[model samples]
Target: MVLPSVLNADFGDLGGELQRLTDAGARALHLDVMDGHFVPNLTFGMPIVEGLRRHTDLPLDVHLMISDPLRYAGPMVDAGADMLTFHVEAVDDPAAAAQSIADLGVAVGVAINPDASMDQLEPCLDHVDMVLIMSVQAGFGGQAFNPIALERLRSLRNQYPDLLLEADGGIKASNIADVRAAGCDCFVVGSAILKSDDYGKAIDELNDQIASANPSGANISPGQEATR
Candidate 1:
């Protein structure tokens, strides 16, 4: 699925970016909420998320890179987040945090930084609707993709065959195929699309590529080695 990362969007012209993504058939909007304490970079809060809620009808996939996700889960959900995803390393109780988000009647997701392992999220897998594998460090955007994170996503795809496997960070047309082959059904692309001169065209191209690779929209089975 196409999910445009809002972090790279033109904040000064937020509505324009949202409209561009929506017009280009983006399935969801990825909101990256970062707290300086957890990731060394501060980002938008509930007000922005709430304001964006009125801009588009696409599902708001909010990614929380903060210390205490539980504290903001309720407010985010109330502010119009359709799916809430938080870092596995941030929360004191990952499973509990996932449950709390799930209880808000929104889909719950758990994210793992490039250095985190699949085993770190094993206990909370069933409670989450999607598993986000960050292909770069959490704080900033436009960084190079970390190859190791691809393996982590491959592993999660093997263990939870039916769960949504999302990959974020350095996602562009160049690496979309490889990520898809690695079993990522959802993608959070930032600078790749937003920074392009033709934002709408970029999104259309990515969607076409994804569709061509998975015409049936079936999740490709992970490699045998990944299952272990």
Candidate 2:
């Protein structure tokens, strides 16, 4: 599934921007909530999520790049977050954090930075519904796709075949195929879609690439071949 991040969207017309993505066939919206302390950048919060909820019915996958997600998770959930992902490096206890978020009745997820390994997530994987692997350093947008993420994704796929693995940051049509082939089922894209001249066409191009890249054709069935 393609989830266009709101961080790069036009703030002047936020609602229209979100609607455009939905019209472009994006199934979900990636809301990056950053606290200045945790990520060196401040971004959207519950009020923004609340406003976005009134604009679109798309599921909000809220990525909390904050130091204290335990304090904000419930508020985000109440603000209409369908899924919440917190960084493993942000909290003291991943398992407890997962349970706390899960207790709020929303899908829980764990995110790891490019330098982190699967071992960091071992304690919380059981409670998470999805895993977000940062393809670039967190807290920034429009960075280049890191090749190392592909290797890590492959290892995760090998160990957890059915887990919903997501690749976030620096994802575009150029690398979506490689990421999908590396075992990512979900994509968290930002500028590629938001910065495009045509939202729907950009999304279609990404979908086509993902579908064609599937070797087994189990996940996506496309008419054209995915170009490397």
Candidate 3:
């Protein structure tokens, strides 16, 4: 699935930008929620999330770049977040945070920084609905996609074949195919789409690249792994 990160979108015309993406056939919207304490940057809060909910019916993939996710789970869910992804390093107990989000009836995901190992998320893997491999450091957008993420994607795919794997950061038409090949099914594109004058066209280009790359592999789905 293609999820356009709103971090690079025109904040003043967010509704319009979201509508354009929806019109282009995006299934979900990616929101980067950064608190000053987690990373160097600070971004939107729960209020913005609540406000955005009114403008779009698409599922919100909320990535909390904060130090505390358990504290914000309720507010985020109340703000209409369909999925909540928290950093593995942020919480003392990843499994608990995953359960906490799941308990709130929202899809839970675990995100690992580029330098972090996939092993850090093993305990929560079974509980999460997805795993996001950050291609770059958190807190910033438009940075170059780090090649290290490809190996992480490969490892995750090899270990949990059916898990919903997503890639975020510096994704563009040039590297999207390679990313998908490495095992990312969901592409979280930001500046590439938001910075372009033609949002729909940009999305179309990304899809086209992914289609041409034709990622080939097999892995167990999350459901199958759980049963195993």
Candidates in descending lDDT order:
3, 2, 1
* 147 Cα displacement, candidate 3 (Å): 0.6
Per residue, candidate 3 scores C-alpha lDDT tens digits across 22-123 of: 898777889999999989999899988999899877788899999999999899999988888999999999998899888988788899998877778989
* lDDT to native, each model: 0.83, 0.84, 0.86
Model 3 clash pairs are 161-220, 162-220, 162-221, 162-222
Model 2 lDDT, full chain set: 0.84
lDDT of 2 by residue, 1-228 (tens): 677888999999997887788788877788999999989889879999999998888788899999999998888988998888999999889999999988988888899999876688999888788888999889889898888889989999999987778889889998899999999988888899999999999988888888888844333201010110
Query: Each model's TM-score?
Result: 0.92, 0.93, 0.93
Point out where model 1 deviates above 4 Å.
217-228
TM-score of candidate 1 versus the correct structure, residues matched by position: 0.92
lDDT, candidate 1, equals 0.83
